[model samples]
Target: MESYTGKSIFQKVAVGRIFYYEKNENIVKRNRIEETEGEIKRFEAAKLVALGQLDRIYQKALKEVGEDNAAVFEVHKMMMEDEDYLESIHSMVREQKVNAEYAVAMTGDNFAKMFSQMDDEYMKARAADVKDISERLVSVLLGNGTDMGALKEPVILVADDLAPSETVQLDKSKILAFVTRYGSSNSHTAILARTMNIPAVIGVDISKEWNGKMAAVDGYTGTVYIEPDFDCMERMKNRIAEDEKKRQLMQELKGKETVTKAGRKIHLYANIGNVADTVSALQNDAEGIGLFRSEFLYLEAKDFPSEEEQFQAYKTVAESMGGKKVIIRTLDIGADKQVDYFNLDKEDNPAMGYRAIRICLSQPEIFRTQLRAILRASSFGNISIMFPMIISVKEVREAKRILEEVKEELKEKEVPYQDVETGIMIETPAAVFESGELAKEVDFFSIGTNDLTQYTLAIDRQNPKLDHIYDPHHPAVLKAIKMVVDNAHEHGAWVGICGELGADLTLTKTFVEMGLDELSVSPSFVLPVRNEICNL
Candidate 1:
């Protein structure tokens, strides 16, 4: 019985035969083509094919996982169609007289390297995005295809790493689980595995000879047992049964109201990044969407998302929610969520530097464009606009002024829209202290506990070295949350928490006792949280 231990990304269990996926690194040798135009045409043709395949994958993922998760393909499609990216590929093919695959490989490497050097976390992560798209294009150019049709049984897949494109292309029905040799908690494979509710272990190395061997993967302990004895297999089967039983029980709690024992009903909502997430949000029985990270549209786009582009995305999600509240937070790009096209200046300390509301306030037209889109989408269903990183009442008033101006413009242009409620995120210590004054300026307050905790504790949440120091339940962070909740109530404004802390089951009772009116977490947490509230 061969055994290996690695990092467990999610605690779950699965047992099945293993299928190793060692992707052959296709090396496209430099070949001088006779016709530049022909190579360009070939590249364009491959691009079209890749886009079509991505669109199909996007649709499948939308139904299987949800919209926000499916949006990864949308980002890929946009990247493939990006003018700058296309120009680089075209120039390479024409000038270098190289084959389509070589041109794409070279261009992708150049762009990815540029992104990898950026200080922002999101920008740095985009290096992976470029690589994914490039590999897709190359596969299309080479006309390579996946042939797993002969496998009549489901199996746990072991791969070096699974790119987003490859992950989406996988036959989920045949996938028992994912065991990768290399990946981190935030890697695309880990993210997809969690989205699909599949158990996963990463950063483990096993002999290549283990392929096709029966194995048991223990996600909780991060162990992979190859050719386990019959006794070990029995234990895995029992664990799977226990997990299934818990899932069945969870399903029974789906329609249960999230009312406390004291008869206080707190709204349970979902935080989504895109339209795709609404499907899962609804499936998990989320009453509404509390935090829509509007920056996703900006990040997915090659440049600034036009008003109409933003309007379509917002409208799709709003209409899909069937009039349930959807609070769209206006572009929050900065401090780890930077977009390359924005050309935002590098800062010594991005977290405290120009970000969120500061960028929106400085770039009024950008703010106006998003406000116009959100307002226009409000006509389709229940919608509200929220601003992030707001540390002052002055910024709230200024944002409202611009919003009112956009309303008038839309009114004059005869564009119909709902009178969308506006709100601010109480994320900073300054906002906590000034909550009373700030609450009066907005319709509601949504405590962004991720930033709130970080700011209150003076720690960067993204730093792996600071993991031990970061505590969301710290007295200072809790005090800030209680202050925001209390002051908002005092000002006749309700408060909701739409951050990581909102999803912490251990603190659910404390939050409910503190008078938080709503808790917005990820889709998967809605039912579990609802169950917790009922127990309270």
Candidate 2:
């Protein structure tokens, strides 16, 4: 018998396949009708029906966000009214002389193809929306409803990416886990997965070939097992048991300070999006809110929110946290989050393009609006303003100048506000290299490991082919993080982390050893990570 016993410990596991929509498949029997170079009332009626259905769904989702965050819905409304898209659809129908049913189908099929060719994952996923929207219109033309009830139950959802609509409509209670073929770590689906505390693996191979077989999904390792034998099943079972036990033990550490076994105190913080998310953070007994992304403020508004409107939004969160630290990041929008109303142009590589501090510098008015709101709310509780994608000292000085201007304006107007601390996200390679110098100017530092890892490694996070090259555990990445923390501390500033890696179980000890001041992760991970820190 051949002996096959000597082997290294397993580095990673493959448990599933990612499924992407086959958008290239040609539509059959696409009936073409002769056109008369004019708008057809029948096609217009079908478009109206589709828009109306979208409106109903939008209103329902808006209520969950409240009046403050309802601006995002307004953008969706505008998207439906995009004149170019409407014109294209009309041209296709009039020239092809097809019925409204076939017209909608062809348009959807064609749009999906166009979207898939884009470099952005967000735009690519938007292709699915095009397909879905057109299909619904076709259903209306056919005198039928798009029934999702036929969706198979108790099966893992596989897709190139999942949109907010698909995620919200899914029977959350029945989903075991979802795997996507493509998406950034901060993509909407990944954010929803963390918010929902569901196990999910993105940018992986997910297919139906393993139907009727148990596939062990390891969200932490980003792997899936297909048709595992008895031994593999037992090993995965043991791993699951261990994970559960760890979680149970971590629950006991809730509401307690994360003091290490060696008497080192580490702050545990929550990374939240909007005010609605603060409830979960507090429920988890977090020390404070470390990274409160302010992009949502700009995303949901019909227009630029008045300072007062922005103030109230910030005030709600401050009051909820009382005296706890709330590090609110300034508007971080740019290339990817294209708000056409703002006249922001789409870029080939938005991540590396003009965004964050760059946008704020160009449009001081927008930055001032957010800064004024944050400063006004500061009086209510602890609040800090953090600038993202900080690469130059000039941007820092300019941002500070704007804040000062806001303060002076508020003072002249006799508005009540508190003086606040300012900080920068040390995510770029340049920022890390200059931490020693930059630390002297900022109140503190928050290491955004996601971008830091990507930029430092010179890898596009969305590229699965280069996934092997993107390593947060590599010696170089670890050294960069340590350099930032050490330099920040040396300059008399504290440093915290607001990246996904901050929540990793294995890295907790490494961070503790490095003497990190705080860890801000998803609210659900607070208890477990704090527990790990406490027992360190």
Candidate 3:
């Protein structure tokens, strides 16, 4: 047996046969069509057929993954129906006198490559959208649609990587696990694997020699054993059983309140980047959404997201929480997370540079649009607005002034929106020192330990060489947390911690004693954190 390791999207175990997913290698590049009219007709006909297939996929996705996720297929349909997109294809067919399949392939490659070349991560992802539609059109033109069929049997799907469209077309029932050679933990495949509760490991470049081999996939350890011996198989089976037992026990904690040994109740919440994550958040019985990273909206869009678009997404997530407190953090851009469209100048020191609330305050119109959306979404359920990377009273006041402007705009339009509370992230050392005064200005205080630790320790968490010095549990870090907790309570504000530190089991007791009212963590950690709280 040969064992390989990578990174797991979620922790699960699966023993299955390795099935290499093959891509279509044969595609006609160019074919002369004497009848120009016939070629254009063929392109139009192929589009209609693609739409029919997309409609079925959309319906299935809606029923299987929910509306927000199902919108992937809907997006493909819109792209196919777009006048500019169709014009490009039509021009290729008419001017170049090429066949419909060739025109589609060429156009798709051009557009996809264009998006792929962009600096923004989300815009670069749109390359997948172009390829998805183009592939469907070309397949229709060629009279062959491989994406239409189901898998013959269950297997651990092996691929170099998976596109968003390819990932969605998969049959979850037959997918035992997903093994990829290239993909980040935040890739579409990784997110889908977590949402569907499937085992997945990425960045492992497995050779074809392992195909058809019986494998034991361990997501926790990121190990894949190919053609394992009887002894190895037995050990893996036992490990799987043990993990399954632990999972079953964790399931029992769902919907139960997190109470400490002294009967102190604490709210346990989930942190999410997008709306689709609401499923996993709720499944783990999160009391609410503690940190909604709203930058995803701007990141995913081709340009700055419109107010209505932001409003719909926020409203959907809020409704999904079903009146549970949903704290949406405003755009936390800059530092490692940069937006190309924002045209931010290159910075020598980005971590403490212009970011988050600084960007919003500098650009009032941009900030106003987001505030309007959040206010509009407030009507659906319990929603609160949070500002990150905050350090001063002046910045907080200016931000609130623009928020008030948006509220007035909504009122003039007679929009139905609930009165939403506002808060600031206690991340900077400046904020921590002035926590008492800062707490008095906001409805609540959320200690963002991720940045707070980085800024306080003067260590770039991203720098691997500084791993030894950058301590999350440093004495200074603990002292800052205690100070923030004490100040928040003293000034009539609740305190919560929404960072990697919140999920640390060792710190749960310390936080409880320090008077933290809430702990926000990832979905899978919700139960473990709650269970730790109960034990304490």
Candidate 4:
């Protein structure tokens, strides 16, 4: 028996035989081509084929993982049509008189290197994307298929790493879990695994020799046991049964009120990134959407999304909730969620630098565009707007002033819009102190514990070295949350927590004791949280 440990992506236990995934290795050799134009033509044809493949995969992923996750394929499709990428391939083929495959390979390597060198972690992850697309194009040009082939039975899939395209294309039902030798929690593959609710562990030292052997994956502990002994297998079986029982119990709690034994109800809402995620939210019986990350529309787009585009997305999610409250957070871009079109200057400490509400206030035009969209969408269903990273009362007033101006514009134009409820995210320590005055300006306050903890601890949450001390459960952070809740209540403004800590079951009781009105988390967590609240 052999056991290895790595980082867990999802907390679930699985017992299965090991099925080592073998990715098709495309080896492109530089070949002198007499006709450069013909090579370019060939590349263009292969590009079309790749685009078609991506479209199919995108649609499939849309059904499987929802829009935000599926949007990676759309990005891949966009990459296929990127002017610079095409030109690079064409220029290489024409100037160097190389084969299409060689030109594509070289262009991919160069572009990937450029992205990999970027300071932004999000952009750096694009390196894998470039490589994935390049390999796809090369495979198409080579007259080969890039399918992972069907599996006869479910097995624990072990691989070096998986590209987003490859991961989505696999037969998901046949995959009991994923054990990768190399992957990051931020990688698209890891994100997909989480969305699919699959048990996964990354950065494991896996061996191909374990293929076809009985194995158990302890996702909670990030341990993989290959050909485990009887005692280990028995323990794994018991754990799996317990996990299954808990899932069944959670399912039974669906449609039940998230009320404590003493009859105090907590509105258990789901947080979503895009419209399609509303399906998961409703499926999990979320009372409402507490945090609709509106910035994803801008992040996913190549340029600033038009007001109409934003309206349609917001409208869809609002209508889908069927009058359930959808608190859409206004564009919280900058810092970690950087967009190229924003043209933000590089900052030494982006977390504390210009971001979120600061960007919205600095560029009111952008803020107005989003507010107009949200107001327009408000007429369709229950929709509330929230500004993120607010620290002062003045900023809240300025934001509300702009909202009123947009409302008047809509009134003048006789465009239909409802009076939307307004709120702000309590993320900074300053917000905690100013919560009394700030609460007077808004209908609600949603404690963004993720940022609050980061700021309170003065720890860079993104820095792996600080992981040891990046405690969201810190007493100071909890006190800040409590302060915000008390201040908001004093002004008759309800408060909720809509951060990673909200999903922490250990703190669920603590939050209830703090008199939190709501707890918003990912769709997968809604039922479990409700169960916890109900039992409380």
Candidate 5:
């Protein structure tokens, strides 16, 4: 191999390393059947040490960052201590008489092989789970930590996979982009990465082939280019300059009203999860908090949070916004995001079955607790309650009934409260059809286009086979959105959209044309969206 040249003409090569966890682990050659008991014990000892290290890391994060900020580390801690995973490792060691290293190495190799062979993109990305666990194990075993100091300059981080803890600890300013060998655009890491407004690429293959190769990744276009010819690099440079110019202009527009270049008024808002997210929203110059998904209150707790707990969480977000409108969706949990506390009954078609309002109706106590919490929080700042997945006027009436009941209870307890505006999310076609009727009862309406598209098209957005049918721009989806907006407006209720479709530049004008009063999207989209709105 005196003269070896192996390269592809691809524009961008993903970066990763060929990590071999099997190295130094006494793996008897497959052909040799030597005793592996001692090696197995050593592997088990390594596993124990790794798990213990995870606990220490979790504690360190908890001490460095508050409990809420260290949620990712907490999740990792739970995963490491999960009985099933621990039992699996112990069982493998006992059954095979091999050490923990061999078990983990074989598990990683097998999973990588299985995922690599899978045709489904979503499932294939799960191979990153294997990579994640293996990476942590390797990191603990060899103590070969990739010092964060090496990335002194602001540049993109290209890797095979990134744990949530890693993402949380990353210095956002130094990271311009995040490209991974395996991930979906909808994955949690991608979600957080998007919030940081750093360009990211996921599901990239052959990342290890590009080690030490300088490349530029365009997260917007999902493109990566290795050492490119001057022409391409020049083009990229010009694009970057243009982008910077546009960004500077947008920065100047911050704190100004979201009015179109034509002087037409449009509302710009942030869709946030918790109090921490409101910080990003305000930073992006969001006029208001349009969609405060209430699921986080449920997800981050060991049990159902008490009404007081929920109230404080809601109040924190509302008070943080300082009178900015915050539309809190009521307990939008079921089906897709089942909570440990609220265990939904398995359904043949969960997407169409008991979810959101359906689940709330069956468990009014839970719904009442949340309603009570929202009302109490309302005393602190501007907050509106939006009932998710309401398909009929009946659900609206029932929710309002529960609200009044909570009001009476609060009054009886002499607790301070505020009168909150009630709204419903028009996400199902049935709900869109009845928007006029629902709007008459509700104070406002928010179109949840994500679910509307899936329900109208009868396609599971997460299903790989039907992902194409999950188009939000389908004419039918547009019609549903238009109908809901018109109905809500005709009924003298403000209508807005809190969906991925809202912030997309391609559809922003279409939404404007459709008469969407407010568009709530991820904070990262705020600047670009505002720029687009100004030019509109």
Candidate 6:
């Protein structure tokens, strides 16, 4: 028996035969071409083919992983159509007088290197994306179709790495789990695995010699056992049964109040990125919609989302909730979430730079448009508006002033709308310190622990090198959250945590003791958290 350890993406157990996946290599050789125009035509034709393939993958991913995760393919399609990328490939093919595959391979390497050298970890990950698209183009040019072939039986897939395009194309039903030699928690493959609810382990040294061998994957411990002994197999079987029992128990928790043993009730809400996610929220029995990320509308758009488009999205989510409170954070763009149409200037430090409420406040017209849309949709169901990255009471006042202006405009236009409860995200130390004054200006406070931790610790959460020290559970962060909750309550403003830490069951008791009014997490976590709170 051989055992290996790695990082886990999801917690589950599986026993299956190992399937070593080896992708067909697209080795390009440079050859002098007589007709540069012909090579350019060939490159364009391959681009079209690659784009078509990306569309099909995007549709498949959309159905399997929902819109937000599916957007990765859409980004790939956009990258394929990027004018600069296309220009580089075309110029190289024409000037270098090389085969289309060669030009594409060279251009891909150059572009990918640029992205890899970027300071932002999110941008750095794009290196893999460029390579994925480049490889696809090269394969298409060589008349080599990119397919993983069929699996006759389910198995634990082991690969060196998986590109997002490749991950989405795999047959989900046949994949018991993923055991990759190389991948990060932030990799799109990891994201897709979580979305598909497949257990995955990365950074393991896997061997093709183990192919077709019996294996047990303990995703909870990030352990892989090959040719496992009888004892190990028995333990794995028991663990799998326990996991199944826990899932069934979670389903029985639906419609149960998230209250502690002492009778303290916590409003368990779900954080969602779009209207489509409301289905998951309801299926998981979320009492309300908290942290409705409104920026996806802008991020997914070709240009600025018009008022009507924004209105329809918000309205759909609000109506879908069927009067459950939906708190929409308005246009938290910039800082990792970039839109080409916004034309935001390059920044040395984007995370703390012109982002979220700063962008909305600086560009009040854009803020006003979103406000109008939210107000227009407020009448559809229970809806509220929250401004993000606010650090001062003055910013909150300015935002509310604009909100009033938008309300007046609607009244003048004789448009029907409803008043929305206003709130601000407590994400920075400045906001925590000023929570008393800021809370007085808003109806509630949603603690965005992700940024609060980042700002309080003065650490870049996106930097993997700092991952060891980037503790969201740091004492300062906890104190900051407690302070915000206390200050908000003193000002008669309810407080809720809408960050990843909110879903940390270990802290559920602490949060309840802190007198938090609510905890909003991903839909999948709603029940587990409710169960914890109920037991507490």
Clashing pairs in 1: 67-276, 67-277, 68-276, 68-277
**lDDT agreement with native, every candidate:** 0.85, 0.73, 0.84, 0.87, 0.71, 0.87
- TM-score quality measure for candidate 4: 0.76
Residue-by-residue lDDT tens digits, candidate 3, 1-536: 88899888777888999887654543767888789888898677667657756865675576579888988887887888878788888998889889988888888889999999999999999999999899888876765533524567788888877655455456677888989997666456776776566789987968877778899888888888888889988987898899888888899988778998889999999989898789889889999999999988976554799999999999999999999999999999987665556878656577878889998888878988899899999999999999999888888888888888888888899998899989999999999999988888899988888788988999877553565587889999999999999998999999999987898888999999999999998787899898899888
Q: Tell me the TM-score of each prediction against the true structure.
A: 0.76, 0.71, 0.72, 0.76, 0.71, 0.75
Candidate 6 displacement at residue 389 in angstroms: 1.1
Instruction: Candidate 3: give the clashing pairs.
Output: none
The deviation in Å at residue 1 for candidate 5 is 20
lDDT of 4: 0.87
- Put down candidate 6 lDDT per residue, 1-536, tens digits, no spaces: 99999989888899999888774568899999989998888787667657756765675576578888988898898898899999998888788888999989999999999999999999999999999999989987775533444678988989887654455456777889999987666555675676456789988999989889999999999999999999999999999999889999999999888888988889999999878789989999999998999987986565789999999999999999999999999999987566657878646588889999999999999999999999999999999999999999889999999999999999999999988899999998999999989988999999999889889999876554576687888999999999998999999999999997898899998999999999999888899899999998
Give the clash total for candidate 2.
15
Please state the error at residue 531 of candidate 5 in Å: 2.9
Task: TM-score winner between 3 and 4, please give it.
Answer: 4
Superposing every Cα of model 1 onto the true structure, what RMSD results?
Answer: 9.4
Ranking by TM-score: 4, 1, 6, 3, 5, 2
- Per-residue alpha-carbon lDDT of candidate 4 for residues 448-470, written as tens digits (9 for 90 to 100): 98889889999877554566687
Regions of model 5 farther than 4 Å from truth = 1-174, 181-184, 227-237, 261-263, 345-348
Off by over 4 Å in 6: 16-198, 206-215, 226-231
Residue lDDT tens for model 5, 1-536: 01112211112222222221111333322222145566555554444445444544554465578667656554554555556655655566667765555566666666567877799997787567555665566554443342233455666566655544344345666666666665444545566676766566666653455545556665445666665556656766777777777768778878878777778788889999877888889988998898999997876564788998998989998898899888999988866565544655545576788888888888898899898899899999999999998888998998898889899999999989887888888888899888889889988888888888888998776453464456788999999888988998899999998988888899888888888889999987887788888888
Better of 1 and 3 by lDDT: 1
Q: What order do candidates take by lDDT, descending?
A: 4, 6, 1, 3, 2, 5
Candidate 1 stretches with Cα past 4 Å from truth are 16-24, 27-99, 102-196, 201-214
Model 1 TM-score (2 dp): 0.76
- Report per-prediction Cα RMSD to one decimal: 9.4, 10.9, 10.1, 9.2, 11.8, 9.6
Superposed model 4: Cα runs more than 4 Å off? 7-9, 17-24, 27-175, 178-196, 206-214, 229-231
List candidate 3 segments past 4 Å from native: 5-11, 19-26, 29-90, 93-101, 104-208, 219-222, 338-340, 345-350, 459-471
